[model samples]
Target: MRWFSSPLRDCASPRDPSVSRSRVFIYLGLAVTLLLLSYQLILDRGPGIGTSWTAIQGIIVAGDEDRFVPDYVQPAEKELVLAAMQASNMSWVEEHLSDWQVNIYRADAKHDDVGLTVPVNKGNEAMVYLTYIIDRYWSLPEVSVFLHGGRYQWHVDNPLYDSVISISHLNLDFVQEAGYVNLRCAWSVGCPRELEPARYLRERPDDKGHPTAVEYPDRFMELFPRAEVPEVVGTPCCSQFALSKTKIHEQSLEHYVRLQQWLMDTELDAGISGRILEYSWHMIFGKPAQYCLDQRECYCRTYGYCNMTDSDIQNQWVWRGLQLPEGWPEQSESAE
Candidate 1:
């Protein structure tokens, strides 16, 4: 019976050197195969992961220098107002008027409390005057509103134009007629109770050169879909990030060119540069939009436009749209 015992028992024993050596070799081969597979996976995924990481790093590094104080107004309040404005139907002024003029007379031109008086001619040949006093102390970026005398006779529904009047009616000339139309508003300070906390936090100025927000570009790139990313750094449109007003400073055109170069060099989105350039122009050079109706020519070499009027320069280039040259970078789907 011993002689007839199966050879399987002998083969399975730990003392069987051949069987033990074979099992060890098999395990080593599998471990080596897994290592190779993992290495390949990392190599294939490197660029995308690296780009996202870099983008996030850039944002974080940048934020360290430029902290963003959240807007004082509640996000809900802003959203509600914006939503109402968007949903409310308003007619666009299309007809050209012979005597189209917009003027902002300092309400207390006599006193220091400056207010704005704006009159617009509705299509029915009737004019509506809107008056509002601007209070600077309410917020660093003050909000303007309507005074007692503001009304629209021609149309029951007149879009509030404190923000728009300055830009839309730049061509209108100011008339100093007495008793024609009058609207007066008193000045007030302090944020609404609901918004006070947010306002207080925002009003505290950040230390210069410290980043208020941090964005990791690399993380963003990783999170972004692969189809949206470009393979090369300088492909048409690739980079997407926010720009700070301080970053541009006085070098408006140069700032734009640098942004464009960065987009191209980094193979981000080419269109983003143009968009950022437009925004910067608006922030730095655009007269309050309410003052300048026909802003198309405002960017003319002779007539740069800006928030405030300056006699020294004929034209201000604030908020000028980009005029890309021919052979602008071609669009690529790989970098959506």
Candidate 2:
């Protein structure tokens, strides 16, 4: 039997197993101690080491001026309008917004009891909205809330899909501050990067089959003369939004006149023309070309629903018997 042993190990005095075990224990103890110290430092930083922890981020703890309710909002200065077809039922506006100064504009060339009717049914709610701005430019309210005629619609940013609930909780002060606010806060259909005009030709076609979307780049240039068309145009959809009077004044009266003229004169289909304007409204009112708001901030700022997590928003999106992407009704009773 040949036994092989290292001369170095034999020469070296037998190493104490207890000493080796103690060294190992010492190394592990140092590691655990360092880890615990690092964990304590992180804990001192708060709930999330780097991210926003709403609990730690104080709210309205400052003076009254720092509050959400600003003194600039006057109830009488707010103007609410509903864009309606001649046959659409507008009883809900009266029912829900009885306190508001509600105005209705008929799109079917038929005069309502209030004698507000668009000259033509050219662009869905776009025509009505532009008409109101042009007709009342000089006598505009401090804040105008433009809405579709229906009380309940999928586009309305509320759990109930109820316009009444949405409007009832609307933060007018936010509108006054923001200058332009889309009533629909949810960014499902339209959001972050909806249209890239420069890449229109090669981009995937719109599921809704909007022909004018292809022509949007040219139309954008035409709508804003001498101005470069933006690479991307986006906002929350469906034509319902709020504009501060000062915001509307940012554009010349003739600018709106030209937009209306284009709507009437353009050979594009009414729906297509309206859709183009729908995407353009944010830019028209001084928002950036890509105007998608953070959903959490939007809910908090626009409607006073604050401190919501991603999970909270998902829970709120309980669609009432409506299928997604295809189940959306092509035409709601008073849809834009």
Candidate 3:
């Protein structure tokens, strides 16, 4: 009767709204802190998204190395001329290489001509013209000695020889088999071994069971040991390396939208096969761009963006199972 309530009842009846609000605020603060910490961690540890993106920014831009040269070139007289130009005055050549008025051309029509023009000061114009003439004559596939060294040498077919040497994406089989060793030796040590054939051929067993095909056997054996020959020798062996499926299929829904956007932005030709798309993405992304991987959510949350495509996504899945390189990866294959 004197308010007859126990301490527990009294406390429950007069709940402190301020205390409840404080608990709510505490929980909210903790959640925000956790989110910020998670974001920071993602930025630090991921598949080099931002770094790759930054690297790729200039890649797709108008003025790029790709725009200048499409493929690799070997060491030859043209390279020596370029080296001379660089050594003599890099700043001057760099400024004048793309001038429409100057019109610099390579000697090797197939390898040296990259179709770049640069403007230069009038005083340096004669030197540039003389250099172009020298390059053209030296680029002749038959030219043997470079003016600078006076050493005998064969012309390398590719103009982007330096880039070829730096490329790390070459096939492992070629690397292990010493496919490029002869070329390296010839370039550096002036070895006299004949250039390895750029093309591959299949050797078939003759009807009499005799060794039938000896075409380029010496060159082939230099690269491949006799014991490791494939059971079916004549069948061409090529590989297409890509990322795993689980990585490709994660976030299928969102990835689908991004793929559509990329397709729209690039204006890629119609009838683009899935395998080609996958290959292109792999080249650009350095991995499979699909969204189905188990840990893709983690990857997406961290990277903020993913390289995915839809038109060829399903096709890639089917074709990937066949374990065959795409019938034609480069446009040149069709030209052939």
Candidate 4:
């Protein structure tokens, strides 16, 4: 009798082994219920298991009108853009979409845009609103075209660029030719024509505290890296940019997940991380030729194309004598 002790025969209820067994089942059932509840919560909060989640090629229209520092605040004129999208019929664009959903954050208080829906007191900013899109969806379109709510100087009806009569028609050709095409603003937007990284990093590294921003000796390295801070940067200088699905497909969804998470969690303002990623988008794609033999072809492959060729190299004008870095293609004989 002593050798065959029951597994659930507690000293307090030795005679009622059945009761103890029943209690064990009760505890087990409670544990299972808690697990199910927790799992449901996860599904509600995130696109959890078996949730046919699809985040693919599409657009993200965001608006945060009143909430930014003066230097970085969004343009106030975005209400006009929203008025246009609502007035026109954009349902046709949905036909080409791989994913059925379109996320819109209206620039004005009058509508329910993503920017308006997101809780303001929480650490959400317009620059990082796109981060919320990636984090919450657990997926991103291969080619994500992000546009600020406001209008820019480059707005065009049509100029012999593409087949469609859309805003994208103005950009698709240029982006196809380059990895990422920012608004070609007045006198070049990113990396001032004269402020080369080589002379600037040692002489004036980014005011310190910017771990992810570094001047790359190899400009090619900035286009993409297995792991490292992006130093080779330039300025599109605003919230408007387009990413190619092919180049973006090179990395896993987890990479974007972590990136968005960091943008949300970090104390550093958009001035740092936002600006870091802003300049880094093209670099994230990849660079081609060390030197452009044919400037036009070299410039054309910069954006939409995945692989750069001998005809590679996006059209970027590097600075003069001051920026002669050690690793990058040496300054041209004439420039030196």
- By TM-score, the best candidate is 2
lDDT of 3 by residue, 159-268 (tens): 22221221222223332222111112111211121112222234332324212222323323432333232222211011112112222232243333333333334322
Residue 276 C-alpha lDDT in model 1: 29
**Model 1, 1-336: lDDT tens per residue?**
365756897667568678789999999999999999999998987666643523443232112243112212211100000101112222221132212221233222232233221121110110111111111111211111111121211111112212233223322111111101111110011001101112223354443432211111232233232322222111101011111222223234443333322333443232332322221222222222112222223322111233433431222211112222222224222344
Give me the overall lDDT of model 3. 0.28
- Please identify model 4 stretches exceeding 4 Å from their true place: 1-51, 54-102, 106-129, 132-142, 152-168, 171-179, 183-187, 191-201, 204-232, 287-336
Q: Which ten residues in a row have the lowest lDDT in candidate 1?
A: 75-84
After TM-score superposition, the amount by which residue 216's alpha carbon in candidate 2 deviates from its true location, in angstroms, is 1.2
What lDDT tens digits, residue by residue, belong to model 4 across residues 207-241? 35534344332222433335443223444344355
Model 3 residue 105 lDDT score: 31
Q: Count the backbone clashes (under 3 Å) in each candidate.
A: 64, 0, 24, 14
**What is residue 276's positional error in candidate 3, in angstroms?**
33
What do the candidate models score in CA lDDT, each in turn? Answer: 0.24, 0.77, 0.28, 0.39
